[model samples]
Target: MRGKNVLITGGARGIGFGIAKAVAQMGGNIVCLDSLPEPVEEFKELPQRFGVKTHYFRTDVTKESSLYKSFKDAVDTVGDLHGCLTAAGVALDKPFQEHTWEESRRILEVNCIGTFFSVQLAAKQMEKQGTGGSIVTIASIAAQGNTCPGQRLSIYNMSKGAVKAFVGPLAVELAPQKIRVNSISPGITRTPMTAALAIQYPNLVKMFDRVPPLGRMGSPEDIANAAVFLLSDASPYVTGADWLVDGGLHAGTSRSLKDPSEQ
Candidate 1:
């Protein structure tokens, strides 16, 4: 990926930041876009820190106008995009009965619609370039299983599920152009986001402690490495594939006596 220009959405920090910086350290030029203020300011240091060209764009991925402008800006800054990693998403953790209609739409609009815009806008730009590229969407293990009690996870799960569902058709559609479409479904990773949650609820930690086969939570680097793989030619033969890096969370937990769920 040396000298290859790539756009990373929600990339100012966390998993997005890790991937962007990792790629940069590998000699790839980065265009990191996120709506958050602090990350944009903080990420400015990446280029000098890693000795790669890195640009920052503040963008609301859910808004079409903002997305178009942000894409153009990223392309203008980095020369043109050879790849994109869409990591922007929102989480709604309220109980199902507690969620309001508007609340669900807002979350889905940000998570699912933002993902759509992220991929759709990138594809249009990639087509105009008439060159193939790679697009990686960041999903979660929650897409695969029921976790977190009292969580109004319907829309979050739905949005993530849609992201996984989208890869196949997109890959088939873009293969003629040599553009790759893939996804990374990560388990819980210790990021600033999850760190806050973990502090708030200790039982959740114990649940992950005993449930997951790996006996530990994931890290941002784990997910970032997978993102790098999906973005790099190392995965040249890969497309429309979903890679799960969740510390064995999806596999049923080991329980011999009474089923854990029943217990």
Candidate 2:
């Protein structure tokens, strides 16, 4: 990935930050767009630490104009992009009945609509450059539907499901341009987003932990590792695919090895 320019949304923290770190370490120039305020010191020091250029812009994903301007600025600052990670998204964990229409709209706007436009904007840049590139969308294990009974996130699940489905057709369309589109469906990962809630309700976190067959929760690095692979040249022949980075959580949560004597 050396000399490559990669753009990441929601890159100020959590899974996005993890991905940014991995890309920078791999010698890729990074441009991060997020709704949060700039972390000036943190982003400015990235280049010195990883020996790669890093830039961060505050942009709201729900607003197309803001996102578009940010995209343009990123290109102007970093040159043509080699890869894009659409990690900007929102989550709603309330029960179906408790969710209001506004919540539904907000989640979809950030998680689905935001990704849709981000991919389009990034693809256009890649096409204009006449260079094949990679696009990775961040989906979630909840997209698989009812994966964990302990929590409720109907809107979030629906939004992510839509994102996961969006990749296949988009990949097919972009193939002619030598551009690849893919998605990563991550399970419950430890991040700032979930930390406060976890501390407030440790029992809920413990319940979710039991759902992963791996006997542990995931980390941002776990997802970032997979994102790097999909973005690298190693996956040139792979596209329109969904990589489930869930620690086998999608394989029914309640399972045990069969007794050899019974066999």
Candidate 3:
């Protein structure tokens, strides 16, 4: 990743920030596009910590105009984009019947529409550069199964589902241009978003322990490790694929069988 410039949406915090740190550690320049008015304090320390160029732009992914302008500015500052990660998303937890039309719309706009345009802008720039690049979107295990367990997240699931569905076709289309498109479907990662969910549904904390075969919730670093591979040259042949970093949650049931003696 040396001399490469990777752009990350939602890079101000959480998994996105983790990816930025990981890329920086690999000697890649970092460009962060987030809705936050200013980059987080930790973002300011990237240069000193990793000796890499870091830039942050306040951009809302839902608006194509905002995304276009911010992306252009990022390119002007960082030179050319070699990799991108569409991590800006929103999650909603409400019973399907109780979900308002407005609530559903917001989730779709932020998670689905936001990702669509972010990837589009990145691909366009990479296409123009003619240098080819890698694009990774952050989907969720919820797209593959009911990850929330007892809680309801019908709309949120749908949004991420759209992300996972599009990567394959997009990869095929972009392959001719030497661009790779893929997604990472994470399961029950510990982020500020899930921390809030844990408060709303306290049982989620317990389920995190019992669910994944790894016997623990995933960290931002766990997901970042996968993003790093997809973004780097190591995955040249990998594209249009969805990597599940769910600690075997998608492989099979994690529940242990009861012993016959106990029964």
TM-score of each: 0.91, 0.94, 0.95
Order candidates by TM-score, high to low: 3, 2, 1
User: Model 1 off-target regions past 4 Å?
Assistant: 40-42, 148-152, 254-263
Q: lDDT values of the candidates?
A: 0.80, 0.88, 0.89
TM-score of 1: 0.91
lDDT of 1 by residue, 129-192 (tens): 9878999998788777566333357778888888888888999999988899999988877777
Indicate which candidate wins on lDDT: 3
Q: Compose the digit string of candidate 3's lDDT tens values, residues 129-245.
A: 999999999999988956645768899988989999999999999999999999999988888888988788887666776678777889989999999999999999999999999
- RMSD (Cα, Å) for all candidates, in order, is 2.7, 3.2, 1.9
CA deviation > 4 Å runs, candidate 2: 40-42, 254-263
Position 29, candidate 1: lDDT: 88
Colliding pairs, model 3: none
Query: Any runs in candidate 3 off by more than 4 Å, and if so which?
Result: 257-263
Best by TM-score: 3
Evaluated at residue 57, the lDDT of candidate 1 is 82
Pick by TM-score: 1 or 2, better one: 2
